[model samples]
Target chain A: MNPIRQDFPAFDGLARPLHFLDNAATSQICRPALEALVRFETDDRSNVKRGVYARAERASVAFDDARKAAMEFLNAPSPEEIVFTSGATLGLNTAAHILQERLQPGDVILVSLLEHHSNLVPWQLAAERRGASLRAIPVTDGGRLDLERLDELADRVRIVAVTHASNVTGAITDVARLRSFCDATGALLVLDGAQRAAHGPLDVQELGCDLYAFSGHKCFGPTGIGVLWGRYDLLDAAPPFLGGGEMIRRVSLERSTFAPPPHRYEAGTPPIGGAIALGAALEWSMAQDWDRLGAQERELAGRMLDGLASLPGCRIYGDTGTQQRIGVVSFELEDVHAHDVCQLLDSDHGVMLRGGHHCAQPLMERFDTVATVRASLAPYNDGADVDALLNGLEAVRRKLA
Target chain B: MNDALYDQAIIAEARSRTGAGRLDAPTVTAECDNPLCGDRITVDLAVQDGAISDLAHKTRGCLLTQASASLLARYAKGGDVAAAGELRAAIDAFLKGQEDERFAILTPVRNAKSRWDCVTLPFQALADALADLEKRG
Candidate 1:
C-alpha cells in the first residue's frame, strides 16, 4: 500500500508528473477495477440472470455478489434495496418520477440551493408533472445550508432531496440532521451521495435517509452504473419505475405484477459489467487507509488556500479550511480569467484542473461568480500537485500583470 | 510540456504586442468568447484595395490560444481578401491535423492543430466579421 500513488495506473507513465485536480468531474480509474473490467469482458463474457448455461449461471452469481457488495458499501440493510441505474442523474430522476407520480397536485417538494443539476432538475420536472410547489433552502455567504429554513418548509414538504456534499463548493450538508427533521415532519428524505461517497464512508442506516443515490464513476468504478438505495418498505410501496423482462413477475392482458424491491426498480438490461467493476472499486476504496488520505488532501488544500491568499486579487470561494469540506477548492483571480488560468496550467505545466461553474449554476449564482477555477484532489495526489499549481498561478499572474 | 512555451520572452511578446502587418485602410474587427472556459479574443485588421495591410489582436486565454492568435495576426496582415479566405481554409485543414502544401503560410501554426480552436479564436472571429462586412457591402 504505497499511500502516495497506488490504485491508479495513470500516475505511472506520466512524464510531466500529471497533477490531476479534476476528481470532482471524474476519477482516474483504479488498477484493480480496470483489471476487473478487462477480465470480465475477456474471460467471463455473459449476461447475468439470463440463459441456463454454466457461463450464464456464473455471471448471475457474480452479479448477485456485486449487488451484495454494493449493499455493504452503502451499509444498506439488504442487497434487495440496491437498484442499479445508468448513473446518479438517472437514479435521482427515477426516484423523482416514481415519487412524483405517487404525489397529488399541490404537494410540496423541498431541495437546497447547493444541489447539482442532477439533484435539482429531477425534482423540478417532478413538481411540474404533479403541479407541485418546489422550495429551495437557501445558503449563507459561507455556503452552508440554512438549517433554520428547513423547519419552515418541512411541514408541507413531501420529498426533501439534497446533496450530502456540494459538487461546486465542496460544502458538506448534514443529511443526518435533515433526515431527523424530515422524519419529524413525515417527509421522505432523499440523499445525493454522488460527491461524498468517494471520499468517506457512507451508511444508509447511520445516515437514516429514506432513499440515497450515488454514481459509480466518481468512485473509481466504470461509468453507466449507479446505485439507488431505498428503505425496503418504501420501495415495496412505490410503483415500478421501468417495465420489462427482469422487473416483471407476471404479465397478462388484464394486469401485470411487478417483481420485488430491487428488481422492480431495475428494468431492461442492467449494466452488468459496470456493476461488477463498481463492486471491485468499492472493495479497493474500503481497503485504503482513509485517515492518511483525508489528512493528506486537507494538507494539500490548506497549502492551496495559503498560496492563493498571498497572491494579490486572488479570492477563494466556499469554505476553505472547513473540516467537513471535500477536497475541492474553487477560486478566481482578478483580471485573470479562469479558462486562461486553466489553459496555462494544463498546456504549460501539465497541471490538470477544472475551470467553470462546475455544473452548479445555483451555487455560482449564490457566489455571484460566472465561473471559478477548481482544483479538486484525490487519494493519489501529493503535495507536489499543490506546488505545481502555485507555480502555474505565479506564471499566470505575471502573464496577466 | 516545454518550458519554452512558457518562457518569459514569449509571455512578454504576447503581453507587449503592438500590431500586426502593413498599415492600410478600412478593415473589420471581431471578438469571441468560450463560455465554457471564459477565453476571450478580439481581432483587428486593416484592409486596403481588397488586401489585408495590418492585423492586431488583444486576447485573454491559455498560452496556446494566445500564441495562435499572435500567429493569425501575422498571417492575416498583408494578405488579399481571397488569401485571407484561403488562410481560413488552411486553418480548417490544420485544425483537422491535415497537411496543407502551402506550409510556409502555416509554419507559425504548425503542431498546434490539436488545440487549433484555442489558437484560432481570433481568426474565426475575424472571418465571421468579414463575412458580415461582405454581406453589408
Candidate 2:
C-alpha cells in the first residue's frame, strides 16, 4: 500500500485494489477526521450555544475550537471571521446575499466560465435581484481564465467571484492578477475554494480575497460542514444571512437585533460534530509534508496525462502540463461517450472517474464538448491508480468505441 | 461486470443507429436533456391518425442513451402515438425490477441507477413530441 493510503479507511479492506480518482468530487475521510467525528458523536453530544451543562459546554468548546482551527487553516485574521456553512454552495450563497447590499442598479457581477455552478449561480441571482448585470471573463482554450479581458469587463463591477481552482480542468486561477483588478476597480473579491481546499491549507489573507468558501467533504472531512471566512469588519457590516436562534442577539414580536460576526451567520443549531471533524481534517492536513505529497501528485498527474496522450484519438481538456494545475485531468477518447468510459473503468477495473459537464456547462460549451472523463488525484493516490485508468481506457475503447 | 452493463446486444443496438438522423420535414419535434449526465436527444415524428407514420432522432449521449433511442425507434416506428409513453412506463417498471423481455438487454443497467436517466431520455422526447402534437390539434 502507498504510505498515505494507510491514513484513509476506504483503502483498509477492499475486494480489489481501489483506484479512487474522483477527489474533486469528495476525498475520502482521513482517520483523524473520522475519529474526531466519532468522538464528538459518542462522548460530547449536545446542541451548542444554548446548553450550559457539562456535555453541552464540552460540545460548545469543541465547536469553538473547530472554528479556531478553520481560522488557522485559512490563515484568517481571527476566529470570528470563520462562519460555519452547510457546504460551499451555502457559503457562496451567504457571501452573495451579504454582498447583495453592495450591488446597485447598473452594476456588474464579474465571474468566469471556469467557475462551477455554485460560484456562478449565486452571483447571477444577486445580479438579477439587485438589477445588476452579469459579465464573464472568458476562458482560454487552455481552460485558464482570460485575464486580458478584465479591464473591459471590470466596469461598474461590484463583486468578482470565481473558482480558486477549476473542478473539471484543474486550472488554478491567477488570483494575483484578479486581486489587482479588484483593487484597481474597487470590487470585492470572493473565491470559491472548494477544489483548492482539498490540496492543502490556504492563506486567504495572502490570496487577497475578501471572502473565501470551501467544503469540508472535499477536504477529507464529513459532509454538511464547510467554512466561509471573511474579514471581521466586512462580516460585521453585512446583514445576517439566516435569522434564527444563535444568530440573533434578541428576538421580539416586531424587530430583533443580530449577534456578532460569526454567530451572526450561524443560525439555529449548527453541525457541531461535522465542524469539529472538519477542523481535525484541516489539522491533519497541516501536519503533513505537503511539499512531498504535492510533488508525488504532480508526477502521478504527469503520468496520467502522458499515458492518455499515447492512446490514439485521446483529447484532453485544460493545461497539458502540470504547472499551474492540480491533479484533476479531464479527457475523452474519440467516439466514446464519457459515461460509457467511466462505467467500464469503474466496473471492470475498479478505476473511479467522473463524467459529464461537472456542473460547469459554460466551460463545456467553451470546450465544445458535452462531457469528458475526469480523473482527479489526492495525496493518497499512487501511480497504480493512474495506470489502472490508462489501461482501462484501452479496454473501454476496444469494447465500446 | 463488463459484459453485463454494456452487453453485446446493447452495444449492437447503439451501433445500429436506427432512425438516427432528423426527419426532413416532421409534423412534431421534441427535445429533452438528461438532467444527470447532460445527454441531449431530439425526436421528430410524423403522426397520422393518432399513429406514428415515421420517426427519427438525433442523440448526443452515452451508449445506454443511444441504445435506448435505437430501441425506441425499433419498437415504436409506425406504431401508435401512445407507444412512446407505454414503452417509457414499461422501461421505468423494468428498471424498477419487473420482468419485460423487450428490455431484458437493459437488465444490467438496473443496478447502475445513475444511467437510468440516460436510457429514458429519448422516450421523454417522444412523449414530449406527442404532447406537443396533442396541444397543436
Candidate 3:
C-alpha cells in the first residue's frame, strides 16, 4: 500500500473501510490541502487585492502565490497566463466566450465525441452565438479519437477542443500529435485537463495547446476553484467573459479600462481559501514521485480490467488495451442496469462507483448503451480495493442473475 | 444471496413477468425514459368498458424497474384507468419509505434512495398512458 493513502482523512474517518472508486468524479482532499484551507479561513481570512491592512496584504500575497503555484504546476510560461475561475465548467465557458470573437460564420469548432458535457456544451454555445458550425471527431471502436479524420476539417476549423484524458473511457489523447495537426491546419487547440491533472504533471508549452482548463476538486484540491491556462499573447487579445470589480484597472460611469490578461478574466472576489488550498494540493502533488503513482494506478486499473473481462457477461468500454489509459474503467454486466450495479455495490460492500452516461452521451451512443458502471482508481487505491470490487460485482451478478 | 434490494420475490417478478412486449394496436401507450440512468419503460394498455382489460410493458432498465413494471401489470389488468393513474402517487409514497399497500411488493426499493426513480418510472409511464386515454375520450 502506498503511504500516501494515510494522508487522506476519508480513509480513517469511516467506521469501515471504503473503497473509493469515484476518483474521476471528485478525489478526496489530502491533509495538507485541508489544513491549508482551515489555516486560511481561521487565521488569514480577508478579501484579497482590495485592502491595505496587514491581514489583507497577507491574503493578497497568498492569493498571488496560488496563481504562481498553478502556473508552475502547468509549466505555463508565466503567472499572467493563469486565470482563476470556479471550476473547469466556468473555465471552458470562459474560453468559449473569449474565442467567439475570432470565429466567423461557417467556421468550425471541432470537439471530440468523448468530451464531458462541460467541454462540449461551451463550444456548442459558442458556435451558436457566433454562427459558426460545430463538428465532432468520431470515436473509434476502441473509444479513441480518430486522428486520421483531422484532415477532413482542416480548411475551416478555427478551434479543436478535446479532453486530455476522457472522463469516461480513460483513454489519453495524443495531444502532441493533436498539436501537430492543429499547427498544420492553423487552428487553436483547447485541452480540457479536468481528468488528467491529478494523474501526472502537465507542461502547457510541451503540449502546445493555446488553452488548458482543469477543476481543483477533481485533482485532490478543494472545489469551486479551477485554473484556466492560456498563452499570454492569446489571453491579452481575447475579450473578457465577465464584468465586475477587481477585473478592471479603472472604471467610471462612462467607461472602464480592464486589467491585464489574467486579472481581466478573473472578475470579482474569487475563491480565496479554495485557491490557497489548491496551491497546497499542487505543491503536495509536485513533491511526490509521479512515476510510482502512475505505475500504481495503472496496476490497479489493469487488475480491475483483467478481473472484469474474466466475468461471464461483462462488457468493458474504451481502449481495453493496457497502454495509454488513466485508471478509469467503465463496464456493464449483461441485462444489468448500471445504477443497480452501483447501488448494490455500495449497500453490500461499501464500494463506491459512478454509474451513468458519465456526461458523454455521444460516446454512449457510440457504445449503444445508455450507462455503464465506472470504477476509477487513484494513487490511494490498492489491490484490496480491486478485490472488493470484483467480489461485490460477482455477488451482484449471482444475486441479480 | 442476502441482498435486500434484489430479494427472491423481486428477482422472480423481474425474471418471470409476462408483460415483456408491446401491444400491436393498444388503446393508449406511453413511454418514459430516466435520462439520468437511461432506464426506459413503455406501457401499453388495452381498455374495455372504461377499465384496463390488458396491460403489457417493455422495460430496458434495472431489476427493480422490471419488477415494478411486472407488479403493476399484474395488478392493473382489471383496474380502472383512474385507479391506474393513482398508482404513481402510491408508488411515490412507497419510494419515500412509506408503507403503501397498493405497491407493497415494491417495499424493497424503499431503502434504495438514489434508485427511487427506477421503481417509480414504470408507474409514471402507466399514469401517462391513462391520461392519454382520457384525452382521446
Candidate 4:
C-alpha cells in the first residue's frame, strides 16, 4: 500500500474499495486541509479586514498568511504578487481582461491547441472585444506543441497563453522554451497551471513566465479558491478586475482610486476559510518528497500505457512516451462508447474514470474523436488501483466483444 | 459475466447487422449524432402509399446503440410513416422505466442511465425522417 493513501479519509470511509482515477478533474482533499477548514470555521469565524474584534483580526492574519503561503508555493518574488480569485477560470479571465488594454486592433493572442476551455475562451472573448485575433499553436500528431511555427505569427503576437500540462493527453508543455520565445517576441506568456500545480513544485521566476494561474481544488485544497501569480510591475499596471468593497483606496463623488495589485484584483470579501485551508494544503504538499512521487507516478503511467496497449482494439491517444507526460491517459475502446465504458467500470468494478472531451473540445477535434475514456492517477494511487482499472477494461472488452 | 450490463441478447442483435445498408432512392432520410460519445445513426426509409415500404440504417456506435438500431429496423418495416413518430415518444417513456411491450427489447439498457441516448439515436433519426416526409407532402 502507498503510504500517501493513508492520509486521505475518502479511502477509509468508503463502504467498498474504490479505484479513483479522476484526480485530474478534482483530487480528494487531504486531511490537513479539511482539518484546517473545520478549525478555522469553528475557532476563528469572522469577516476579515473589517471588524476590530479578536476573531476578525485572527481571520485577517490567516488570510494574509495564506497569501504568503501561495507566494512561497510558487516561489514568486513577493506575496503582493499573488491574488486570490474564485478559481482558475476567473484567474484566466482576469488576466485576459488586464491584458486586453495592451491588445490593439490586428494584434494576436496566441494560445495552444491543448488548452482547457478556461485558458482558451477568455483570450477568445478578449480578442473579440478588443478587435484582436486569436490563433492556436498547432499540436503535432504525437501531442507535442509545434514550436517551429512560432515565427509565423511572431510579429503581431501580444500574449501567449498555454497549459502547463494537458488534462486530456497528460502532455507537459516545455514552458521554459515557451518563455524563451516570449522573451524574444515580446509576448506575455500566461501559463494555465491547473493540471500541473499538484504534480511538482512550480517556480514562476525559474519558469520565466509573466503570469501563472491554478485552482486549489485540483491540488487537494478546497473549492472556490485559486491563485493568480503575476509579475509585480504587470499586476500594478493592470486595472482592477472587479469593482466593490475591499479593493478601493478612497471613494468620492467624481472619481475613485483603487488599491495595489493583489488587493485591487480581489474585489469582494475573499474566501477567508478557503484561503486558510488552501494554505494548509500547500504546506502539506510542500512536505511531500516530490522527486519520489514523480518517479512513482511515471512508473504507474508507464504500466497503465503498456497494459492498455496490450489490450485488443484499444487506441490510446496523446504522447504514450511517459517521459514528457503525467499519469493522465486518454483512450478509446473499439466499438465502445466512452460513457458506456465509464458506466460499466463504475457499476461493476468501482473504478471511477472520466469520459468526454475533458473540457478540451478543440483538442478532441485534433484527435478526430468526440470523446475518450480518461483514467488519471495521483500520489495516493497504487498498483491495486491500476489493476482494478485494467481488469475492468478487459471485462468490458470481453463482454462487449 | 458477473454484473455485466451488456447481455448476450443485446450483443447478438448488435452483431447481426440486419437492415444495415442504404436504401436506393429513399423518400426520406435523417441522421443524428450523440456528440458526447461520437455515436452516429442514419435512418433511410422508402415511403409508398403512406407506409414504410423499406427501412434501413447505418450506425457507428456502441453495442447498445447498434442493438437498438437493429431492433428498431426489424420492428419498423412495413409500418406506417405516421406511426414512426410515436417511436420516439415510446422510447422516451421506456427509458424513464416505463413498461412498453413494443419497446421491450430495450429492457437490457434500462439501468444504464447515461446511455439512454445510445438506445434512442436511431429512433430519433426515424422520427425526424418521418417529419421530413410530412413536410414534403
lDDT of 2: 0.91
TM-score of chain A by itself in each prediction: 0.96, 0.99, 0.98, 0.98
Give lDDT tens digits, candidate 1, residues B1-137.
43334565445545545353323444676778765555677776777788877777767676556656666766667878777876666767765668654333333434544445665676787787678668868
In terms of TM-score, which candidate is stronger, 2 or 4?
Answer: 2
TM-score of each: 0.81, 0.98, 0.96, 0.91
- Candidate 2 residue lDDT tens string, A1-401: 68988889998888789899999998999999999999999999999867879999999999999998999999999999999999999999999998998889999999899989999999889988999988999999888999998898867988899999999889999999999998999999999999999998999989999999999999999999999998888898998888888899888999999999899999888999999999999999999898998899899999999999898889999888998888999998999999999888898899989998899998998999899899999999998898899899999888876
Docking class of predicted structure 4: acceptable
Candidate 2 stretches with Cα past 4 Å from truth are B1-3
Q: Model 4, range B1-137, lDDT digits (tens) per residue?
A: 22445667777888898789899889889999887666788889998997889999998787778888987898788888767768888899988888888766668677767778888899899988888888887
lDDT value for model 1: 0.78
Leading candidate by lDDT: 2
Give the candidates in order of lDDT, highest first. Answer: 2, 3, 4, 1
Q: What tens-digit string does per-residue lDDT give for candidate 4 at A1-401?
A: 78887778787767788799999999989888898899889999899999899988998898888898899899999999999988899999998988889999999999988989999999999999999999999998878788888778687999999999989888999887888889888999999999999786689999998889999999989999999999999999988888988899998989789999899999988998999999888988888999999999999999999999999999998888889888899999987778778878988899999988887888988989878999999999989899999999999988774
lDDT of 3 by residue, A108-130 (tens): 99998999999999999999988
Model 1: per-residue Cα lDDT over A1-401, one tens digit each: 23546668877766668788899888888888888788778777788788689877877787888888889888898998999988899889988966886667888888988888899898998898888888899997767898877787665788899998888778888877797888787888898989887895578898888889899999889888889888888888888977787898999989899999899988887888898888888888877888888887788878888998898888888776748888888889886667667767887778998887777888887887767898888888888888899998998888775
Q: DockQ for every model, please.
A: 0.25, 0.71, 0.59, 0.37
Pairs with steric clashes in candidate 1: B22-B53
Of 2 and 4, which scores higher on DockQ? 2
Assess the local accuracy of residue A282 in candidate 1 as a C-alpha lDDT between 0 and 100.
Answer: 86
Per TM-score, the best of the predicted structures is 2
The parts of candidate 1 lying over 4 Å away from their true place are A1-4, A252-255, B1-94, B97-137
Who wins the DockQ comparison? 2
